[model samples]
Every structure is written in structure tokens, then in C-alpha cells.
Target chain A: MSSPERSSTPMALIVVAWALVVIPLLYGLVQTIRTASALFTG
Target chain B: MAVPGFLARDRIVAKPGFNRWLIPPAALAVHLCIGQVYATSVYKAALVADFESSLTAIGAIFSIAIVMLGLSAALFGTWVDRNGPRAAMFTSACFWSVGFLVGAAGIATNQLWLLYLGYGVLGGIGLGIGYISPVSTLIKWFPDRPGLATGMAIMGFGGGALIATPLSRQLMSLYDSSYDGTAATTPSGSAVALLFVTFGLVYLVFMMFGAAIVRVPAEGWKPDGFDPSTVKSKALVTTDSVSAANAIKTPQFWLLWIVLFCNVTAGIGILEQASPMVQDFFRDGDASLVTAAAAAGFVGLLSLFNMAGRFVWSSTSDVIGRKGIYMVYLGVGLLLYVALATVGSSAVWLFVLLAALIISFYGGGFATIPAYLRDLFGTYQVGAIHGRLLTAWSAAGVAGPLIVNGVLDTQGTPGELVAGDYRIALFIMVGLLAVGFVANLLVKPVASKWHEPKSQTSPTPERSAAR
Candidate 1:
């Protein structure tokens, strides 16, 4: 028997979906580092 | 129901009669390299000295790598299962090698961000993908002894640090002392670059072998001498199978997540400050450099125990039930942390022994859970579920170090200078372990509602058609 379709999002849309997830994660990481540096240096 | 490009169920499950043994060694090779995370401290002093970075700043690099490991693994899990281990393993090796190269570049240029980008993101991705590649395949190949099989593979993951710690230390020393220049203190940049490149190339070759040899067993294939009755006798869950989708919806998945989260967090509290923690407890006004080296050796000793636990304790889970094994891990672990908190370093040997046991259980918990998942859910889509569950690891990677380091940072003085400095952190670990114990207790045999009863009820089409 074949595995059922697990994703309905198109391949292109899936790329966008990943980008959406990854970009926010990177942004938050950058902000954390910046904030940490400021606090420690100050 | 066959999806295009999906391996036939029979093919996916079929036993490759001769090649089964090759998979674990492949897993070990990759694990030995990724295990370098345990030896990160070897570079910490160098990084601080060269870049003028703080302890917390250097720690952030490691934290980023760990957090990314879980995240990338979750992202890559489904792809690994669908595409097979070769693609995933090769990709992991490439990324890991690139990460090392980038890290070397960072050191040469004294650029911190590039090091983070290379080692943290790139190497983390490799870690994530390489870690999961062999897990589901090994479980499927040895369904009767999944705990042992996955443990065999994952034990390598835990042990990787053991091998890496000593090797990295020696390499660093060789690189540092070989310098004949006027600069009396500074390690040669060329030596560091060469070491990184050497490690990267060696790991790439080793990982490629793992990727090449990986093959999924045929569907419904059992080992030639194995009996289902033997497996059932061990008090382990023996389900016909549950799809990954169904498994995720069950409470068992979430409970397992909590158990892992607590176990990892508790262990990391000690692991993050192992060197300092040891020196603080046994302060005798020795030279600072000597004390630091001793502490580093203690860290390496802990790595050995961590590695051993991954194999020995997890293998034990195959005979005892997973829940029963976890009860020991959590219960004993809680007592140990509590003892460490209240005893105030009076019985130093006792402290070391108990801490080692707790750390071993932490590693064991990681090694055993893949097999546990296979037991609760069937091989089908178990990789995906395993991937989703790794988010717990990612969360704990952040939470564990935070609890330990954050407390130490707040305390602001060596434990020797201030009495009971680590008492609060030890108590926190005890509390976390208690939470894990409760979570383990709450894990009931997965409810029948989650099982793929429809698949079970259907006639064995292959058997019937053959007849």
C-alpha cells in the first residue's frame, strides 16, 4: 500500500513555509546576542 | 495506497540478510565526529584568549549549535526516511566539513559570527541529519531487539564526545606547542587551520561510508533466529504498528517529550560547569592552571561514563521494560541530585559517583527513546515522530544550560569563596528529575485508539494471494 499524502502545500509553498520558520528563528537569535552583549558590556 | 516514489512496504521492511551489521558501524563513524560537542571546552580558553570574548559569549556558540541540532533534525527527519540514509548522510558530512572549515576561518580572522555560522548552523544541521539516519533503519532491522539495536547506534553518539575530547585536546596542544616563533603564548594559526581541515576531511570520509552502506530492511522481515515470543516476554510494548501521524496525536508522545526534557536539563546543569564544579568542591589552594586541567580531566571522565551509559543502560532497556528502566533513571537520578544539594561536598567520592550515574542515565535516555518510539508506534513514520520529539532536545539544550549557567552567573563568585553556591542549581536539578519521574509514571501503555487497527483487521494480502 502507498503512503498517503502528508502535505497539501505545494513544493514552492513548502519552501516559503520553511523560510518563514527559519527567518524568525535567526532574527530572534540575533536579537538575543545583541541584547546580551549590550547588557554585559554596559 | 502506494505513493509514487515510496519504497514498497515489503522492500522497506525486508531484511538485507548479509548487510545488517554494516549499519551500526556507519552510525558509529558519524557519531564519533559529531560527539565533538563534548570537547568544546578545549577550544573555549583559546577562543576567549584570542577573541577577548567572555565565558558566556563562548557558551553561546555551543548553545546555538545544540539548539540548531534539534531544529535541523526535525526539519530533515521526513526527508531522510523518504529519500533514504545515503542522501541525508552525505549532506550531513558536507555541511559538517564546511562548518569546520568556516570555524577555522573564523579563528584565523578572529571573527566570531563566522564561527557561529559555520559550527553552529552548518555543523548542527549535519549533527541533526546524521543522528536520525541510522536510528529508524536499525530499529526496523532488529524489531525484536530494537532497544539494543538503536542503543548500539546511539551509544556511538554518546561516546563520540569521549573520543573527541582527548583527541581535540592533543591536537590543540600539538598545534599550540609546535610554534617556534617569538610569540611565546599564542598558538599558531596555521596549526589550527591544518587541524580543522584534517578533522573535516577524515570525518567526511567516515560519514560517506555510513551513507553508502545504509539500507532499509524489507517490510515484515524478522531476524532468522528471532522469535516474537522472546520479545513479548521482556514486558515491552508489542504493537502491530501505528503510523507516525497517529502517534503524534497520542498523549504518550508528549509524556515522552517531558521525560527527555527533564532528564537532559538535569544532566546539563552539571555538565556545563563540570570543571569548575569539581575544583570548587575540592579547593586546596593549588595552582589555578593545574586546577583547571584537573577539571577538564573530570569532564573527560564524565564523557566516558556518558558514553558507556548510552550503550550499557540503554541495552538493559531491551530486557527490562522501557518504562521500568526510565523509573530507575528518574528515581535514582532525583535522589542523586538531592544528595548533591544537601551533602555540601562532605562525601566527595559519593558526589562524583552519583553525578556520573545521573549523566549516564541522561545519555541512556537519549539512546533508548528511539527504540521506545518504535515499540509504541510502528516503524512506519516513526522517524518523523522521532524528529518531532527531538524538539524536546532542542528545548532542553536551551533550558538545561540556561539553568546551570544562569545560576552560576547570578552567583558571581566561585563556589569555594561562597559556601553552598551550587546548592540552588542542584536543587533545581532534583526538582526537574522529580518532574521527569512523575512523567514516566504517567506513561501508560498507549491507548488502543491510537493503534492502526484497520491494518491489523485486514487480511494478510500477500499470504492470502500466495496461498
Candidate 2:
């Protein structure tokens, strides 16, 4: 529900939650890319 | 009576300025953590050797957890809605983490039954509750874009595997000094036990987000600019609510069950066979067009698409409408299966492209259904309805593999099979998609007798604020 009040999410909490989701995905992506690159080089 | 301070039922009460956007991340926190269920195979062989038990026995542990997941959701769906997400999440976090702890002890002591009881039965109840705990709240919060909201969380379930697979390997290597990270070299028994304990503690801390931050909207709090009238214009979308008990009696409910069943079963026809299918398609006596390593890469590529499709297609459903999006999944799915059947294996790029798209639709099929349930059944007991419907996934889990494996076994062994050997299974998948299409077409709004009385449908200020 929309409220006239601005987002109450703490600036600190936002970083942590985003990190919770984004960091793992980024790591997985880098690992996958490395594996794919090796496959091509071989 | 709920325990003082422990009873989180009051968390559902929406305060005046509560932010709805925080809810998706909270839901993601739980789903991603519990989704480690898919990565259990990373430890399977090690457990088998350590306990000196069969692979079947170890695999049964996962089966117990999944079956319990469905049963717990069906039994507790209504209780969850009444008690609220915080309570359900709290209990789920307890069961899930305890299941891991018990499982860790089981592995340490080399007791198989303890492992099953801890991770299988108790942990499954955790999975079921955790899975559904966020659904009804997400729907209520994002009534205007239920598809997009639920999709973000459910997509976590799909992505959880991607994260878990690698993380499990890394954790195992970290714990086991002797570890060489390869499929053949397994993690140590002690290492797996430690892994379980670590997962238990990590998940307990993570799942608390939904339990703490989640709140229900106060009565009559619609998002700004959202017209309640627009929901009616979408086919089968309803403003009314249905009791979870009466919902099963309706044809629409069963039809949706069928839609989910057929879609999941058809999708698994590819997923279950992904590794072998690519290799088999290009086999030529001793020289295969696709290498075994290349085929593994293909599987990894499909996993990425599978996760993406859950977020992308389900979010798209918000714009095109729920029923219209399902039509895309089923109708286009049928055509894709046909292409894979008739002319698949013709080229490297062609086969990969079609297979990846098909898998995306597979993931899309799962992510979109919760929003569809919200559309047809109303948010009254959607979590429970969703809980009951997961029985379709469990059923398809068995049936899909049987059809594919059965058909393939008849053709030839895995490596020796050729493109022609799979045409039968591919055609079968096309037929399965067709059945899903018809089920989608048959869905309609629930009748009035089953609907929650009008007064109860809207959140009342007195009752919401009563706590």
C-alpha cells in the first residue's frame, strides 16, 4: 500500500538485504563464467 | 494459547505508514535459505560411504522432506493465515534449523534414522511452512501486482539451487582439508555434519527478517492509483475470498491443480534428462557431436534460464493478465516441444536455444501459479490453496520422470540412444502441454456460496486494530 510517508527502510538495512541476494548471485555468475571460459579455451 | 513474546500473530497488524516494498526481500530471505533442499545431492555420496548405506536410502531423506513439505502446508495453510507470517516463520525456522542440528548429530553419530527424522520429517515441515508463510502477505501487500511480488520470492526458490550448488561445494572444501573439488571426490562425513550445523545457524538468523519486518495492511489500504474495479476486468480474477476447506470442492480449484500438474510433468520431461539428452542427441557410435563436458555446460546454462524465467515471465503476467500469461506458457510450450521433437538435434545452436526457452517456460509455470491462485481463489486462504496445490508438484515429480525414463529405457541405454529414441518422449511432452492449455481455458471465478461473506472480505478497522 502506498503511503505519503517516505520509505522507512534504514539505509544500513537496505545494503545488507541487497547484499544477501545480490552477492551470492554475483559469485555464482563469476564462477559460471570462469567455467565457460575454460571450456572454450580447452 | 500462544506464548508471550514468542507469539508473533500480532505482526500481521499493518501500522499507518508501513512500507510494502520491504516484504519481497523478507520473503526471499526465507525461500533462498530453505531452498538448500535442492543441493542435498552434493552430500549424498559422502553420506552413503560414511554410513555405509545405499544411495536409495540417502535419497529417501530428500523424499521425506518434500512429502512432508506438501502435507504440512495442506494441514497448516489456514492456521498460517490466521496466526500470521511471523508465527509461521518462527515455527518453520525452529523446525528447519532443528532439523539441520539433529541431522548434524545424526551424521556425527552415524545414525541413519536420526538423519531422516531430523532433516526429512521435521525439516520438511519447516520447508512447507517457510514456503507458504510469505505468499498470502505478499499477495495482500502487492494486490495491484501480485504476480510480480510473488514471482520475486518464488524465483528465489529456483535461484537457491544455483547459489546452493556452488556454496555447498565451497563449504565442503573449506571444512574438509582433504577435499579435491570434483564430482568423484566426496566431502567427508564430519565435514557434512559441520555443514549442516552452519546452515542451521545461518538460516535461523536469515529467516528472522520476514518474522520481524512483515505486517498486514490495515483494512482498506489499497496502493495509490490501483482501482479495485480493474481486477474484475481480468478474466477469473476475484475480489471475494474462499475458505480453504470449500475451495477444494470447486471445479476451478481442481482445474488449476491439473494445470500445474501437466505443466510441471511436461517440464520435467526435459529437466530430469537434461544431462543425458544433449549427449544422446548427438551420438554417433563413438563420436558425439556434443562432449560430456559441453553437455554439463548446457545443464548449467538451462539452470540460469530456469531462474530468470521465474522472475521475468511471472512479472510479465502482471501486464498481460494471469490467464493470458498461462496461455503463453501452455500454447507456446506445446509448439516448442513439437519443434524439439521434429527437428531437434539438427544443429548445436538450434537445439540449445529451444531447450533453454522450454526450460524458462518450465520455471515460469511454477512462478506464475501462486498469482493465478490469488486471481481465481482470492487472497483469503491463498497460502493454503497454494499448499494444497503443491501436491501436484510432488505427483508430477514422480510421473514426469517415469514417463521420460520409461520411454528412454525402452529405446536404448543413455549413451547409446539417438535423436529418434527421444521422439516418443518429446511428443508425450507436447500432449502434456495441451492438457495444461485446456485446464487454463476451463478456469472461472468461484461461485458465491463458497465466497467469504462480504463483510469479512474487507479488512475491518476495529478488528485489525483490536490487538
Candidate 3:
């Protein structure tokens, strides 16, 4: 069996990369959810 | 134009031990920005009022943009493949940002043609190139789960409007203090101009980030423990690669085209009329039981379902196989359309549920297609093939609205439509879905004649030299 390749990339880089996209995406989803809630609320 | 050495396909090859997960975020950055194409309605009325033009004239800006998106994708698919993702993405950012800058100028100067030339043409080219840039890279990264990788990126496209709609409102309100973000008020033309500039600069930065981070996989790289033989074992999945040129000549490509056209057409029927359809369905003579606010909420809800379905259903395709998942999208979708036409108006909840489910299938069809192409065509030129297939989307963009609007126009005018007005359109969608279902059934493994020779299947000299 081949040994797993060691990743040189830092974990923080991955987190920062994801955070740049995910934070805005979550904000958008939240905003959409708030607007959509009006359907069931009424 | 010669690609700069730094932006060449050879320069961005991944080294050993690179994490594949980083690619999705890069893909999202571009998609989220281009997906802003859908949120044009936020400032649409302002553009119409400012230009002193009819709604159709202002609406043509969006139509032109969508048409250009389809055209540019088909035209540039192969170029993007040869040049690699970074170059395509950087080029897309330039066109997209400059498009907005020019569009802002047009808006400020009150020149409508400039808006058409800038936002509609230039920004749409950005939309097309940016859309397919990362798809093949993502598929390459996640060979074991092509659908999931693609779903993540395309979901960003759906999510783009969710962000842009609210963001545009806030930005417009900031620029035009006289106009609050409400139906009763429209922002000034100048406000929209500033909003375009802001979107242009912001999207340029975001898309550039994607370009920076995206890297093509090294030759012969695969995820640990992923079995290529298992993938080939599945029905209709090909181990061999087909060039985009030959792919077009095949029956499978055209069948998938028919499949996509039908799916998108049916989905757009509900999406284009989502807000009003809810109110019309529940109308008690003159007064709608559904309020305008609730109807807007229904649109919001459908957008949510649309975004979620892109991720959920495409991911599910990894487990169920692409053909089977599409059967659900088309076969089950036909029954859903029938239920919608017959019983949708009987209850508000039923109407919303049916519409939301149908919208979900529409979105699933979009997100799942790249992976489907990968299955039948292999990754060699799958992105280009995928881009060619998007012509169906452009076609459906016109056909879907035409069928719905044509039928509705015959029955009654806007604001006075009832559920019965939509029966013919819904039935037409049902017929279209039946067509797509049969296309899906006809899909088979690509004939061996279409496959590239063993010599061509390996990484080219330029890519190997990059290493």
C-alpha cells in the first residue's frame, strides 16, 4: 500500500480561502431566508 | 492575443501534495460574481423609468446579456481549455469589470446603446467565460465525486442572486437617499450607475481571487484510494476521452442538449412567473388570498429551493448515477407539472410546494450536467462540451418565457391572471419533460470511434514541460 502524500499547504490557508467565499455566501442565504420567511409567517 | 507567461496553462500546474478542497472556493468566487446576472430586476425599474423607455426595451439589456453568455461560452470553450482556468478567469474579470465601468458611463450619460454594448455584451462575455472556467478543473480534482464538486460551484451561481438582490438594494439606497428599497420607490439612474461601478470593481477583485487560487491537477493525479475501474464499471460512464469537436458530432451530445433544453424550459415556466403565480392561484374573485408581500416571499422561497436543489440533487447524483437522477428530474417532474396545473390552485400551500419542487429540479438539471458530460465524454474536453451544451440554456431562456407569456397573454393581462391561464403552459412543460425523459433513456456510452487515441489521452508537452 502507498503511503499518504504529505500536504505542504497550511491549514490556515485553507480556512482563509474558504472564509473569503463562505462568509458572504452565508450572509446571502440568511438574507434570503429572512425574506422567504414571510411566506409561512402570514 | 498571446497569454502572459504567468497566466499560461503550464504555469499553474499543481505540485505533489496539493489539497484539492481549495478549488471549490476559487470556483465559487467567480460563479457568485457572474451569477449576479439574475439579480438585474433589483434595478430594472429604475433603468426603465430613467431611460423613459418601455419595460421591454430595458428588459432587452438582460436578454442581450443572456444571449451573449450562451454565444461566448460556445465560442470560447475550446480556447479556455487550451489556455487553462487562470487565464480564462482573468480575462473574464477584465471584460466583466470593464463592462460595468462602461455601463456606468452609459447610465450616467443617458445613452441606452452603451448599456447594451457594455453590460449586455461585455459583462455577458465575462459571465460565459467565468462560468465554465473552473468546471473542468473541479471535475478533474474530484474524479470520485464530480457531481459534488460541480454542485458546490454551480450552487454559487444560484447563490449569486441571493447576495446581489439584497446587496444591490442596499447599494442603490446608499447612492439615492430619496429612494428607499421598496416597491413604491425607484432609485435614480445615477444611483444605478454607481451600483454598476461598485459591482464591477467588487466582482473584478473576487474573480481575480478565483483566478489566483485555481490550479489544474498534475498529470496522472488521482485522489488516494479512488478506483478508476469502479467509475468505468458504471453504465454510460467512459474511461476514454472525446474531443469537443467529435463530441458535437455524436448523438449523445444532441440528446443531452434536448434533455437540458426541456428541463430548463419547464423550470423557467415557474420561475419567471413565480411571484404572481402564487397570488393568482389563490385569488378569491378580485382579492388575492395571497398578499403581495407573501408572493415576494414565494419568489424568495423558490430561489432558496433553486439554490439548494443545485447542491442537494447534484450531490445525490453521485450516489444514484446521473441518468437515474435525471429520470427523477424529468419523469417525476412531468407528474409534478400535471399536479401543479390540476390541483395547484386548490390550495396555497400545495401551489407553493409544487412550484418550489419544480424549481429545484430546474436547478438540479443545471448543476448536474457538467458531471453528466464527464460521465459520457470524459474530462479531456468536458468543460468545452459543457459550454456547448449551455446553448440549450440560451434557447430555453427565450423559449420558456415565450411559452408562458404567450399562453398567459392569451388568457388575460398582468395582475388579472388566474390559475386557469397557466394550464396550457404547464401542459406544454409536461410535454417538454416527456421529451427530456426519453432523451435521458437514449443516452449510452460514447461509441469507441469518438474516443481519442492512447497517445492523445496523456498530458500534452506544454503541460508536462510546466512541471
Name the best candidate (by lDDT). Answer: 3
What 10-residue stretch in candidate 2 chain B is worst by lDDT?
B458-467
Give a tens-digit lDDT track for model 3, residues B49-158.
99999989998999999999998998888878878899999999999999999999999999999999999999989999999999999999999999999999999999
Per-structure clash totals for the candidates = 10, 0, 0
Candidate 1 accuracy as lDDT: 0.70
Model 1: per-residue lDDT, tens digit, B218-249? 44557788887766554436555665556778
In order, candidate lDDTs are 0.70, 0.83, 0.92
Q: Which candidate tops DockQ? A: 3
Lowest-sum lDDT 10-residue window in model 1 chain B: B458-467
For every candidate, give the share of true A-B contacts it also has.
Answer: 0.00, 0.19, 0.71
- Tell me the alpha-carbon RMSD of every candidate: 11.6, 3.3, 2.5
Report chain A TM-scores, every model: 0.54, 0.69, 0.77
User: Which pairs clash in the backbone of model 3?
Assistant: none
- Individual DockQ of the candidates? 0.02, 0.31, 0.55
Q: Between 1 and 3, whose DockQ is larger?
A: 3
| Segments of candidate 2 deviating more than 4 angstroms | A1-11, A33-42, B1-6, B458-467
Q: Is candidate 1 or candidate 2 better by TM-score?
A: 2
Give the Å shift of residue B88 in candidate 3: 1.0
